[model samples]
Target: MITAKTMATGLAFAVLTGGTYAGASTPKVKPNIVFILVDDLGHGDVGFNGSTYYETPHIDQLANDGLVIKNAYMYPTCSPSRTALATGKQSFRTGVYTVPVLEKGNDQVSIFSRWTVGEEHIMYSQPLADAGYKSIHLGKWHLVGPYPKKEMEASWPLKKKLGQPKPSDFSWVPYHKEHCKAYYPEGRGYLKNIGGTYRGDPALEVGGYKSKTGGYFAPFSNPFMDQKNPKDKWLTDHLTTEAINFMDEHKEGPFFINLHYYTVHRPVVARSEELTEKYMNKLGDPKTGQGMETGKKKLTTAQYATMIESLDDNVGRIAEFLDQKGLRENTLIIFTSDNGQNIGSNLQLRGKKGYIYEAGIRVPAFVNWPGKVDARRTETPVMVTDYFPTFMELAGIDYRGQLDGQSFAPLFKGEDKALQARPIFWHLASEYRNGTCSIIRKNDMKLIQFLATGELELYDLKKDPKEENNLALKNPETAQLLLKELTGWRKANNVPLPPNSSLPY
Candidate 1:
């Protein structure tokens, strides 16, 4: 456990020589951490990850210059991923197995949804805050309870009037303002929060005609953000600006910023006319090319590509800021996504987001620490939960608590062979497609057990990355061993199962 005295000593050392007290012999400098989390970004979405459609030069260059984690895992959905990341525990502990509500169209809830992440949990930032790290949370902050209970109750009449209430209906008013103030990033641990709200994306419009809450371009309906875009800037650009400014303000020593960009998620909007036209002409069918990816067929391939490019461009902006400020060598940038790819992009992977398949859980993760981490690719299975311990170790703090993740800081230092072998577990107990399921991946073998139906699917991820062949029945021994381990872990964690009663659709 990192006592307050230890943290104070580390802070004193950092103040004097820009290094931390690793011990009497070994002293290490804590790097400024910039954690960039994208929403609903797919495994095959970035240029470094073999996305022929989208262009991500900055992200690709980061991967080329740093470490690319090929087998990094996250929860199948946003809330679960954020929950595990915040608490350093799996979904079983947080009860944030999936997005609170899984709605069909926009109004009808097909899945049994409940409030997931709450304020009482010990978020990673709380520890960092105690360690004297000035933290900022930019962009989406869905870890708060899905929404105020009052807002959910207010939507009933609108739901009855129109199959589903519009995005505008729930975005603002008296209640939402109160809710945002009560459960936003500042209420959590961030000293400053811009564009951080309860919902995934406030860009939702009410009409079934559009898929997003609101368009990606401002004027955004986000209550937490100011409508100060006179030039009608893109949301990603605005967020990048805020993050760069925050870094500049806190360029003294060690700091942590969670820049969760709300781009490339959904309600896929076109970028500037120039970039949109470039992608459209580059990838769109000449004769079949219509408008952006929102009409008739809603072929948003070109729009999605543009969104990625914009995200990459903003990343370049951050990189430039770090370099120009001479902070690149001391800043550690960790780039990843909340969940997996959205539909229409990840065809090669088994399933899209919101499933137990690799496509839904496997995400692109890259860590860059100049003068420390080297450029390489690792197939070691690392979960988002591991980031908590890894960052704590980097800050020269010993975090002792009930944590489900092990620090991969040793792997970052090129001691790749030193990492201890362990099984990474995932529990998605919500009313999605196949009901509730639990997964455990040990080494190259993975076993998935379905709750609704007593079924098991085993796959050798090394041999079949696509999970095409299930060797559960064929290799009973391997399957049984995996099941025993998974069940034992579940029993230990007290992971919840779906209720016996039929779910309300």
Candidate 2:
């Protein structure tokens, strides 16, 4: 175990730096971490997930080299899932259940604590930072704003820049980019931060849409497109490059990089002309920038294929970077999405993006730690909330506060029972576009309740993984038993109130 004195004495650093790349001494195993989190990539969307329609070869490579959790989960959508991930706790516990667009300082509507990222709570990066790891976050910071247009026009941050539209799109409120400081990778305790969007960039020039960050616009537009002095790199390349540089500088010390991306999220075109042409006009016009007609046809073979292919390529780049740096053997590379895939993302999943269905909550999770972890696929049910405790245990760090998750570190070392079979709970008081209000899945037996009408449905996922069969009617007693378990689980986790935030000073 890495004790406080060991960490303070720079043992982790000395161990990390002493060995050469090709020539090894003690394997130079300091365990650099790279966490690739895609925004809105779904369960049924990739080539690995029985997707004959789309290709995600790069993402699939991690599966060949690491454990792929088939039943991995997150919250129903972006902000909520992200919140759960950062805190290792639920949204309600942080009072951050929905997408927050307003800033506490700016003329924004969403309060950080009461609406989005709870101001009263700290995040996972804090623990990593305490251990002297550099935490870096990139792309798709969506919870910050729908921003008030009037305040954005007069806001100090936005006003400092020249020739930009006022954040007037969010009614009269300004985009709440300030509250983002609390949860941003650097704010949470990263050594540095790369990319995150507080408000939509106005220069993409989609005729109908004034703001160009969220929704269906450009699939993978460069974040530095409007920069006066732009860097010559693709979005994925830039993220990977920064990661490599960080590793180079801290080759001996531990580092945590949150390599987030806005891939296959919306605007399903690739950056290359050849790839973009395949998706262009197949789904929507890139120049005109609009989505395909509803019910007319969602994802074209080319568009869907391109989206998956590009995302794969982007993920694969990180793998390639690791190989080049000779950091492949010791580093733990975890690839996961914030939530499930979105529309046109896949067909096997019933719902997309913002719903509480299996498609929205279930995600593809791959952890690649060369030579350390067995390169095999596992059906262990895991959740995003479990990562905080898992990493802490893995890095041998200490913490004074409470966390809602258990460490899956033993599983990485080829140990059993680390994927401990437990009832993972998800409580969402917010609106789901479709699907039921609440759900409980354990040991392949799932129960969903439509809270509006007090209706209940049960499915044996082992028999009907797609949730086609409803066994609640046939087994009322069994359904009641599971429902009781769900209630009990929620209470045990401190589901509603924010424990850390609610404490009296």
Candidate 3:
């Protein structure tokens, strides 16, 4: 816990030194915060991060205008990542290691002791709301409730299935309505929630990911979103318009907009025919090989590209709205994603969404506050859990709670050695396309421990960005030291492990 006096001193220093950065000046008032969280965007998807396939001029401009973090990380899947962001705690504390029960397995093989985040945990929005900031949450809220109620469990979808039920085997919403209502964004301190709900993806509300429109287009089946205008054809555009309206209504003072967009996720559909044709042409060019060579089919890749473009367009709209309202100088914007790419390529990354590898955990991130944050690229490592403490520090709130993340607030003020060298961890006890595992990354060294087989894979991330070589056998000392630390962490946190699994440490 950071003492109030220490926090005050740090904030005062930041305020006084705002003029140190080029083209930056101190602001007289509190800065409004707009956190834009995109779904399933990879580390190499944005133009600023070297993606020639998908165009993202607006996102690139935002990164150029702010601090781009080179080594940012998140959980392998959405639920754990969002849970970590909301509570600033690891999944072991919240019991949301992966997607709900389907990926969690039945009682015979289940690893998770709990399925949803408890109502007792303090969310990042609570402190902001207490400070008189009107906050709104838009799009996917998968943190609420993912497990079925006790009564509903009598008709458990996989009560008598074979060995273990796959995630695709279950299709119905498993949560009780009233039980989950208390965990919604509104109950958790947001003043308003536009499209947030227990549903993980847009397609879940209409039908399983195969629905024609998959709720990406207008006439969405999302019960939380109230559509009034007939011109609101695309879901991304509609969410952005709502966000602009909220900003317009609250233009007088400080506000917090948690704009979590459910774009480029599963059920990939093009926002418009024009955008689809544009990507098709771009991919068909000889300069960039056709989509078929990229693992995903050409049409699917084209549709996914359109989704990415639509997200970028909405980001531009928000940026333009801020500038038009004269709120650019006083507003803080953060652009990031939940996890790695789901449908499209993850560039040279080792694995995609559900694997506990570089591609699945690492993500692209940038922070823009005009004068407060320096416009420079940094190699400092950051995590999704760090956002809560960072936001609390920026908001000038003295938060005295148990958090597993360190605040990277000093990095914004051009402090290169702000965060200390410490071991960061990820524990995914449940299975999600990969086996149960725990990971530890300290400095440039990373170790992945497979629970079932007790196999260890070590990599020096500085040399092996793609994680092609496993150095566990070659460099036994470093791997053993990391494993010792990881085991100590799990034991201290009382992290749940799979049944009948053993750890060498």
Candidate 4:
């Protein structure tokens, strides 16, 4: 398949060749890009997304300054969603399948390029590199698979067979205050890289911003665990400090800093015992966490509430950092999540972090770029695939071929509207190999096709926000129309046919 991420380069090439317009005055100001992606954060997790249970003051402030895509969406899992964001195309096209794929044997590693011939032009780094902007990807690299061991290729059949997760018997996260070859920030295409937990702090040497981490194992603590200071600041604080420093150093030129956070995911432990106690107290009585497997202790609605609060604080720090540096104007600060989560809060949405349901796929996205967009809400359904195109627009890059994503930049600049006729498609073929064959938002009106059972479900999102009403049989014509579009999309993208192929049967 001609992956669309690289195709967008044609757009960039054309724009660059068009050169400076005779009458156009090139703005001396070069904008910086901040792509903030959180792992497993969902529609109900933040205040903007209806999480009244906990506050999101920073996110709220961002919304005040920029437009929030009320209908922003991503795949239900990490790798595929990240792949779409990285490639601006569905996982199937890039071989991601919109779902996580695990390999127990050596026959294949699962991720498309994991088994493909040449380096799939899926990662956005190389293109951004070619664009003269410093691009960095920190935090959870769940998309490129396990860190360190997996150095993506200029070509594939990746000699580094994506490895097994290191047993997290100890603190998967440690307060290592040094950055070395193991920590290659600029080498990783990021001028700065202060990723959390799984990807240790490369900041003692490298510079960047923060937001921070967790994980689990039924037994053991690090024998060498830093007892020197039983209580060090939470890893998030360190991350933020570095991020601020990075911005301070790089504000002179155009840069892309992806400050990824590994918080609000798993292990559910606090940075310190006191904070844990504070959280436990906040949960009040505790039926809410009974029979839960949070590891350290039973959680209360309060601890969940506290964890979210801490995450919010991290957001505020980054925004405040930008304000302090006066970098808020030309910098495009985008906040989004890799997938969905159910750690806390309630927003009547069904499903959790890994399902294709709206609850799982719909994510919280707010862009705070002054003068670029208005502080309002939009119901235009945008997807992770859209970022490849959107970033190109920000960089003044033009694409020259068919792209799966339509740049929402027009909408952000006030040139478009919320409701458009374009259809967003998703294919999660890996799950079929694991169990059921499922395709979502299949029709224009939206249908779910379950190949295993030969069952189909339909809903009109306009009439039923909860997707409770079935309209497939009630309106077969609409269903068929949508199915046709979806099938064509898959076919055009070279997504395998179902069953015998990588698609569904």
Could you estimate the TM-score for every candidate? 0.84, 0.75, 0.87, 0.75
Candidate 4: lDDT over CA atoms? 0.56
Give RMSD to native, each candidate.
7.2, 9.5, 6.8, 7.6
Arrange candidates by TM-score, descending. 3, 1, 2, 4
Q: Name model 2 segments beyond 4 Å from true.
A: 1-29, 100-114, 143-180, 199-229, 276-301, 413-415, 418-420, 492-505
In the range 98-132, model 2's lDDT, one tens digit per residue, is: 45331222212122332235333446677677767
Residue range 240-305, candidate 1, lDDT tens digits:
988888899999867898999988777777775677667656643222222224553344666667
Q: For each candidate, how many residue pairs have backbone atoms clashing (under 3 Å)? A: 8, 10, 0, 21
Residue-by-residue lDDT tens digits, candidate 4, 1-505: 1235544553563354332111112245557888888767777667676554455787877876688887788877666776677656556556655322342223232323232211333345545565677665555554433333333333443322343234342222332223222333333345444342232212211111121223211111222222222232554454455566677777775777777665665545455556556655442222222223344444544455555667788878878877888888888889998777756533456566766667778888988888777888877777787777777667765445334676787777553643255677777654522323345452236677653454677887767766778888999997777666666665555555334333342
Ordered by lDDT, highest first, the candidates read 3, 1, 2, 4
Highest lDDT, which number? 3
> Which runs in model 1 stand beyond 4 Å of their true positions?
1-28, 103-113, 149-165, 170-182, 204-213, 230-232, 283-298, 415-420, 501-505
Q: Where is model 3 more than 4 Å wrong at Cα?
A: 1-28, 101-109, 113-115, 146-179, 204-207, 228-230, 284-296, 418-420
TM value for model 4? 0.75
- Over the stretch 377-494, how does candidate 3's per-residue lDDT look in tens digits? 9877898888988877767766656567877877987755546377789988777777888899988999999887789999999999889999999999999999999998887666
